[model samples]
Target: MQVSTILLRMPNWLGDCVMTSCAIQKLRVTYPDARFILVGSKACEIYKADSLTCIIDESKTYPKTQRWHFKKQLVGLGVIAKIKAYILYSLKFWQRNRIYATYLLAKSIGKADLSFSFNNSFFGALFLCFTGSKIRVGFAKNARSALLTHALKLQDSHSMHQVQKYEFLIQDFIEPGLFAHILPLKLPQSTQSLLIDDKQHKHIGINPGAAFGSAKCWQKEYFIAVIEAFLDQGHYVYLFGTDSNLSWQITQGLRHMSITQQKNFINLTNKTNLTQLVDSIAALHLFITNDSGPMHIAAASSTPMISIFGPTDTSETCPWNEKIAKHYFCSHRESISKQSLVVESNIAILCKHLSCAPCKKRTCPLVHHNCMKEITPQEVLLIADSMLVS
Candidate 1:
């Protein structure tokens, strides 16, 4: 039952990858001597510790081909010839890529005793099967139960946090009582120190972009108001996000602020990578963000955060550090009043008729994002002020 060489297929998104850190730590402790091979996206770089023997960057491993270019090149050919050319090119393209991927995967997972896939997709199961490990473990959903040597049933409740859901994959292998003691997610200390001259002022990070879509994003004006509130308190504000068009729009809004406001605010959107983002967040006194990937990253960093939730289910994706942090749900249950209220001992539900929320739609199907729009900046700023003071 001892695993000598283990191949772990990680989740794809940045937030989910962050959540896997705790589970990975548990596995490492459970199999102290096992050699670990990680197959994941660029976000998985955060898990590259001494215990990891190899990391297969899934993004780089399967490079995307330019099928459009081939189509354009064959534009001058006869209709039949073009059709024939397209078919031939498509087959050759897939065959070549398949061979390369298979070779790389085989090399990465050579002679593995066990393989675990944290992803629940059919393709993830197929990847584990192709690794040729003697024992393959994964969730039994997506009709991939037959592919796994040991398949755990998916948790039925949508309220279960992803961290707990991932732990279900390896529960049978570890000791009975060890699940409750899973390690907290911790980022590796940076070798290169972050230099910031103003140590006197408190630093706050604001993330306005959500990778899921605009439906999860709060208004840019609301973000600006929050940033201004922090600046007024003589605190430094740092904006975090990826290099997307939406991030650029948010950055541009910040750029047009007064010279004094610009001096206190720093726009780091599109600039920092995952490692750098972790280091930058680690330097913060507080973080205010949407229910996005960076929100989860800040949670893992153990920063004091206030996550604004709209459209997405807070019970499922609320920051794992909810006890230490606070979340404002832009939603309302049937019996709750229109105003924000403490429904539970620690949790607060904020909104007017959030019946439209937890819609899970990337964009509002009704073309009205009232769920997010209804959340006022004053309420959020008030919460941030209280957390910072406490």
Candidate 2:
């Protein structure tokens, strides 16, 4: 089909949605004039910066089941101990009322020439079914194959980065050698850069929270130390997160609040929405982040960053760019990573290699939680110094 209007069902979480960009970039290149209608939450709204995209805010419509977040319900619960909890969680999916509601929601989106879902849930597949698109494409997981016109199998055994999985799906649709060169696309109006305030002070952003869970989070002491160092160096530090409560949690209340009250510190935790977060990160001289949603956004903004990693596999979810692609994602899984994914040669990635690392768990299951704790503040500050200057 000569697709003119494309409907995209985005991945639920912010990071996964951002990872879909490379494939989407290819899709856009293949059909530059296509009208892209995105079905997703706040993350999808970021696409507003693009000229040819519109978003449907389904952030509150259905339960998000990405990455098996249901595991949170199973935590610390035995077979008989939390039967009600189990039943309620199960009902959230299998309930007939919600199913019908999903159909209604899907039907309302109207039609498109082609529709593709990066979302892995049944809701994603079901949405495609009711959208009445000319062509439907999605992964054939969770028994949703019959609904999609093109159902690709999950390549879990290959350990492909989520970006690669999307690219592999998109490659068939993208004609062979259609474009002379494939380049990484950054967020609109962003450049590989450092922003100086008043031509004197450099602005930096710190996101101390990870939405996934504690296991993915770096220790607060390191964050505080890094923030302190930035302030001492006469740099403006902005704290970013989804809510103000996170600001309180990270700052640890009154004493720290007073310390951050200095003009160099701006607590933008509750202040910026996802769109605003993109703009803020793009404006910063440097961004220091844990492997989280904001980290992905900062990466997309083409902002220089030092991304810290722990339990989550960096292969699956590193801050990606075209160089990273040629260096790692495009290569065999067994090929050793030289860690040269840095765009503009200014990105820094810190991942401590431990046998127990990349467990992909929400919480550290061990005594020491050594994976996150071991990444010191000194290394982060060292990276910050270079990013600020560059």
Candidate 3:
């Protein structure tokens, strides 16, 4: 059947959405005339060039009732009341708007001739089913095989990165051997010129907050140490984070520096939106971050990066361009499992001795984040120096 309109259900997280860029680019190349509609988070707007119609915000379309319930239970237990209350209020707002958003999404989906879901969740499959597009395609996981007209089996190996996994799913629809040559992600050129003094000065971007959880975040003390080391070496530092409280804490730590040092450090936490964040990252000489969404965004921008990893599987979620970034693992399992996948020339893996790494917990199960603590800032700085020099 000739496909005139294609509706793609994009992955939820910003990092996952960035990883889907290559495959989405491939689909655009293969189906140049077909109209494309992307359904995912607002972050998916970054892929506006490849898409034709509009982006469906998943946060509105699929309300996070399970998370709301979990947090409400936490609030009842009197664990961090203030924070939980704020989160609960936000979730309630989303819940109120979800039905109307879902109605609009259903109406949009009904117009598509074919639908594809990059997401592996049962809810994603259900959304495709609701589209009633007859030609729904997606991975047959979460017991959603029945919902998809063409359900591909999930790959069993953990060796492949998420971007490659996305490509594997997209290959079924395209001609043989064409998926291998898809172009890498490139953001639109910035209209406003970047306001910086000297282009020759090395600008290092530091992202201290990880939205997934604190388990994925390295110690703030360690981040401060790295920032100090860079400033001492006459390098400019730009701290980036989405969390206002965390950003303020980091900013306060550097407030006592001399005027020279203060001038070299810039805190951009909670300041820029998604589009501006990309533009800012594109101007950086290097970006050092935890395993977060911006790490993938920086990687897609082709900015050199050093990503600190804990608990999460690096083999599954490492930056797509291995040749341009270094990944430091906190656990032995990640170091061992991800060693073979690392690009020897551009990528290096660092790990300290830890038995409980790859714990895969949102928060540390043992109440100690030794995995992230043991990795010293000096060690990271040495590697960063080498990467910059080379």
Q: What is the C-alpha RMSD of each candidate to the true structure, in Å?
A: 5.4, 8.1, 8.1
Q: lDDT tens string, model 2, 1-390?
A: 677888888887888877888778888878888888888766777677676465564424444542146667668988886787667766655433446656766777788887898887887878888878868888888988988899998656346766777666666678767432345535554342322345577888888888888788788777887887777777788888764666775566324544534666777776765566777788878888888888877777777888888887777788876666566655353332234223335567788757887788899888577877877898778767767766
Give the range of the ten consecutive residues with the poorest summed lDDT in model 1: 324-333
Model-by-model lDDT, in order? 0.71, 0.73, 0.73
Q: Which candidate do you rate higher for lDDT, 2 or 3?
A: 3
Off by over 4 Å in 1: 49-54, 57-63, 66-94, 97-104, 191-195, 255-257, 322-353
Decoy 3 TM-score against native: 0.81
lDDT of 1 by residue, 105-219 (tens): 6656665787888877776777777777778899888998898899887646453567777777777777767765645566564643232558888888888888888888888
- Evaluate candidate 2 by giving its C-alpha RMSD to the native, one decimal: 8.1
TM-score for all predictions?
0.83, 0.82, 0.81
Off by over 4 Å in 2: 57-96, 154-157, 178-182, 189-197, 252-261, 332-344
Q: Is candidate 1 or candidate 3 better by lDDT?
A: 3
- What is the model-wide C-alpha lDDT for candidate 2? 0.73
Sort order, TM-score high to low:
1, 2, 3
Clashes of 3: 0
What value does the lDDT take at residue 19 in candidate 1?
81
After aligning candidate 2 to the native by TM-score, how far in Å is the CA of 298 from where it should be? 1.7
